[model samples]
Target: MTWYRRYGRWSLLLSWAPFVGDPLTIVAGTLREPLWSFVAIVAVAKVARYLAVAGATLNLI
Candidate 1:
């Protein structure tokens, strides 16, 4: 609770982490983060990660 809010917006970035990412999402829910904002943050982070990986795999990065 306190830990999640402590990080504030930065916590949204943690959604990209491996095992810890799920917990961070749960924390986001428990903290009642703005729905669209939370979705946008997580989606962008994950999509950016996948795009980076795809680019690297294709030797574009």
Candidate 2:
């Protein structure tokens, strides 16, 4: 089975991760995931990651 067949939409959550993010985005395109959903999911994941990093930094300071 293909990556899409295995992971499906859940894989989009990893699109904001480092190293793997770019490739995951490419996979999403190759799989023809809907633009709106892709943008929305990726945006949310990225924002959450940013917030977590910011929070950790502030706590360390």
Candidate 3:
């Protein structure tokens, strides 16, 4: 009985790491200024991360 058993979806969030390097970077950058830039970077990182996940999932299928 692990935490993930109750929070399975959390694994998908961890999947973000392949593109988004550090959590501190995201938090620190968002805190700084230029909010749109932070959104853009996060968007790109998420897109890349999804594509990678999709590729792996497809290969598994």
Candidate 4:
């Protein structure tokens, strides 16, 4: 709960982290974060992660 207050909108970025990312999403909901902000942040983070992984895989191949 305290973490929610501390993070505010920035908490959406936590959604990209490992294991704890899921729970942070739940916390974001409870904190009433802006829907569009959460969507946009998470979308960008996930997309970036995918791109990085793809680049690494291509390099390895």
lDDT of each: 0.84, 0.84, 0.54, 0.79
Model 3 scores worst on lDDT over the 10 consecutive residues at 7-16
- Collision pairs in model 3: none
Q: What does candidate 3's lDDT look like per residue over 1-48, in tens digits?
A: 254346433333443574544653454444462556555655676787
Model 2: what TM-score? Answer: 0.83
lDDT of 1 by residue, 1-61 (tens): 6767677857787687799888888878887888988999899888988998999999999
In candidate 1, position 43 carries an lDDT of 92
Residue-by-residue lDDT tens digits, candidate 4, 1-61: 7767876777777676799788888877877788898889888877877787898989952
TM-score of each: 0.83, 0.83, 0.51, 0.80
Local lDDT at 34 for model 3: 56
Using lDDT as the measure, name the better of candidate 2 and candidate 3. Answer: 2
Return the TM-score for candidate 3, rounded to 2 decimals. Answer: 0.51
Mark the 10 consecutive residues where model 1 has the least summed lDDT. Answer: 1-10
**Candidate 1: segments with Cα more than 4 A from true spot:** none
Worst lDDT run of 10 residues, candidate 4, spans 7-16
Q: How many clashing residue pairs appear in each of the predictions shown?
A: 0, 0, 0, 0
Give candidates' CA RMSD values in order.
1.3, 2.1, 10.9, 2.1
Q: Summarize candidate 2's per-residue lDDT along 1-61 as a digit string, tens digits.
A: 2877698767879877889988888888888888998899889889988888998989952
Question: Of the candidates numbered 3 and 4, which has the greater lDDT value?
Answer: 4
Q: Name every residue pair that clashes in candidate 1.
A: none
